[model samples]
Target chain A: MTDTENTPKQTALYDKHLEAGGKMVDFAGWEMPIHYGSQLEEHHQVRTDAGMFDVSHMVVVDFTGEDVKSFLRHLIANDVAKLKEPGKALYSCMLNEDGCVIDDLIVYYLSDIHYRMVINAATRDKDLAWITKQVENFSVDIAERDDLAMIAVQGPNARAKALGLLDAETAEKVDALKPFYAYPMGETFYARTGYTGEDGFEIMVPNEEAAELWDALKAAGIEPIGLGARDTLRLEAGMNLYGTDMDETTSPLISGLGWTVAWQPEDRDFIGRTALAKEKAAEKTQKFVGLVLEGRGVLRGHQKVITDNGSEGEITSGTFSPTLKKAVAMARVPVDIGDTCTVEIRGKQLKANVVKPMFVRNGKSLLEA
Target chain B: MSNIPDDLKYTKSHEWVRDNGNGTVTVGITDHAQELLGDIVFVELPEIDTEYGADDATGVLESVKAASDMYAPLTGEVTEVNEALDDAPETVNTDPYGEGWIFTMKLDSMEDLGELLTPEAYTEEAEA
Candidate 1:
């Protein structure tokens, strides 16, 4: 789901999804498809072939002005001033004064005075408010790209399928884009990044072109994936869903996203830096870990985790990995906990071993490490 | 959508009871129940030989979306539970009325079968 179902928001591709027998659900604030028929089959399609996802529910905001980079340096926890080259992107979390996560976003440096940010739609209101408040004194203007729609073409053959739909010039430029890189050719912007833990491109184009582009990609043999497979794919990839894995009350340090934080350039002042430094010094109680159930039963969120070291935690995100053929979950446990824990499933305690994440990537299990 | 065999009795809660005519009954969830649940992920059926009341929670059925309790349709002593669910719970999604049958029980009170819904009534109620 991309938008909250209680609301009336719908993505540009909503009709197409429904036409294809998609099961609609409320995500963020929009009605989005969870799947077409079998979520597991869609999950397998992405791992083995190519799949396209409607990610237009995400908010794309463009910042233009002389002080755009300077404004972002104060708005995000990462050092965006370090992004020297155009078309380079950095992943960072915007934190509040209390050092809690406000939202995780991707910032792309388009030029010295232009930047583009893609943020979760669920936090659009608050994110806009926060950015507006910070840019008051800076020479920058923030504009939301409501006219744009995003589509993620993922899996092993995703690039080939996407390239087949683009013009020769754009295809050549897109072909040269490296991971964490983006390039704009005409009205379409293509980024060589995805959330599926697979190689792919995230294409952003005008709303009118979205449906046509999706149709072209489908014609090129890309499967139309829905939110159900998206969830399982990201879970298997060890990627965190914003609200489920972390929220306004949780810090990124304990949310299995510490690596995304850039701690260098102590002189660089970003939002929540002081509090994060203090928390870093004090050391937190929570630690995120991956759990694989050794016995029967599927693990799910809110399930109690009893560690061998007398520590307790709860599963934040759990699902049956289509790629792994077993139940896997991400849990936030006490920092002192050992490598093994027991999950309480239907009154029976099941043993689960803890490990680092990235359970599956590129159709291969990373759990062996 | 699946056909509820005229010979089987159903509970409003969606469990189907098939009479074995030997003071015993086979039990499983209705096809409509499985369709609403999408994909069956896990099932926790009662152990064999367990004594249960007519309305007792005999087991649990978990899907990718939610978890539901399977209620006993009649007072009985459990004789067997479907072990195939341990490997492939999706059998319930594929064949809810036949191969996905949950358990069998020896009826302690045969009169309880009269309180169960007939195939006709179950269909109308499910549709409504």
Candidate 2:
């Protein structure tokens, strides 16, 4: 194989990942760490103590210029104007005309004239084109800033460890920011938002300075975690992934994203509003739930869930939860299904209890005793 | 390069077989296979009395990343299974050919062993 066609693109922290014994894999066209040594150990590390991740592959987009506030109001499903206080962030899904989710992103309202967003790396091209096309008439400029590198320091003790890496003055500025908020450190940005179900910070720094900060954090005992544990952690947290949980053909209504849609304004008719209304009235819309396997077997993606009523649904994402010591999965099933169902594995059908898509949060199992 | 024992026969699917001289053969995954699967969490071995044809999928092995089925190397009847793996699946990753032995099957015929790949053949095929 030639050098050019050899592998996917690497992030700025590629060296650091290698130095930490990370097993690199191609994920969404980006070379990312899947694990350092053992995925099970990494998963437990985040739950008990602290860990860090190289999330530089995600794209950062900035929307600036006049009337930016009004332009974003019609472009996205969530109400961007809800950020009455600057630095407040909103989680939203950018939908197509048919109410299908194009991508789910986090929007940081820095000001009325400027707003920033973090989009999934795999959906970068489509999301950027959609944003550029939607702002045709509005006086807003879409600038895709690829020069920034992102790192997520997550877990119960993550914030304290991250604070240890920075100087006193910088740490004090970060300590003042509340959850779901961000603080600008000159050109650097730090937000209290994360995919893992833990208290942590998602820091976006200049590309050149990413390695130094990662090394500094590593020195403080914040081990480098990988995408393998990242999946189980987010799945346990009940967070929806971009492609596995939902995609262009799937709606936020059936894909566990109905809450992100803004329906209050009554006048802010965003894209896909009509189709979303039709879906709300339809009885055939699929429902989302979590399946906790009660029998022997690991729940895997694309498995069929057979309800007691004889209806079936498909699993969107599934994995072995390290914390719970059981197989858990997110499934989209018929609305009339019961609180328990059978997951078809191999030639046998296994029993699994149905619950909210979340299994663990804040280092505690949410499942009832 | 992983450990490919000199005396054991190999399957292209990565299962290793050893003749116990009592007409029954012991079987487990090779070191190369376990390395690819990485820290196996679960293993599903066939029942003790189960009979299987050559190349039949007897059971499954699962890791954190994915799952794969284990295929029988020859026509045989399972005589015993590794009971220790029920609680400690990591044995497959730690000692794939020793304590991690999956099952022992009495071969229908000794001639069937000749059809499996030799160590030299398997090493060349796997390294390729």
RMSD values, in order shown = 2.3, 2.1
In model 2, which runs have C-alpha deviations exceeding 4 angstroms? A1-7
- Put down candidate 2 lDDT per residue, B63-98, tens digits, no spaces: 888999999999999999998998888899889989
DockQ of each: 0.52, 0.69
C-alpha positional error of residue A160 in candidate 2 after TM-score superposition, expressed in Å: 1.0
Candidate 1 per-residue C-alpha lDDT over A1-369 given as tens digits, one digit per residue, 9 for 90 to 100: 345445668878888898888888888778888888888788889999999999999999999999998889989988787788789999999999877899999999999999999999889988999889878999998999989999999999999988987789888999999899999877789999888988999999999888898889999999999888898899999999888888888888889988877788788788888888888889589899999988766778889999887778999999877788788999899988787889998788899999886699888899774
The residue ranges of model 1 lying beyond 4 angstroms of the native Cα positions read: A1-7, B1-5
lDDT of 2 by residue, A1-369 (tens): 254265788889999988988889998788999998788888888898889999999999999999799888888899997998888999999999999999999999998899998999988878888888888899988888889999998999999999887779989989878999998888789899898898899999999999999988888888889999999999999999999999989989999889999998989989888898898888764898999999767998899999998988999999988889889999999988898999999868999999999999989999998
Q: For each candidate, what is the lDDT? A: 0.88, 0.91
Question: Which residue pairs show collisions in model 1?
Answer: A2-A27, A3-A27, A3-A28, A3-A29, A3-A30, A4-A27, A4-A28, A4-A29, A4-A30, A5-A26
TM-score of 1: 0.95
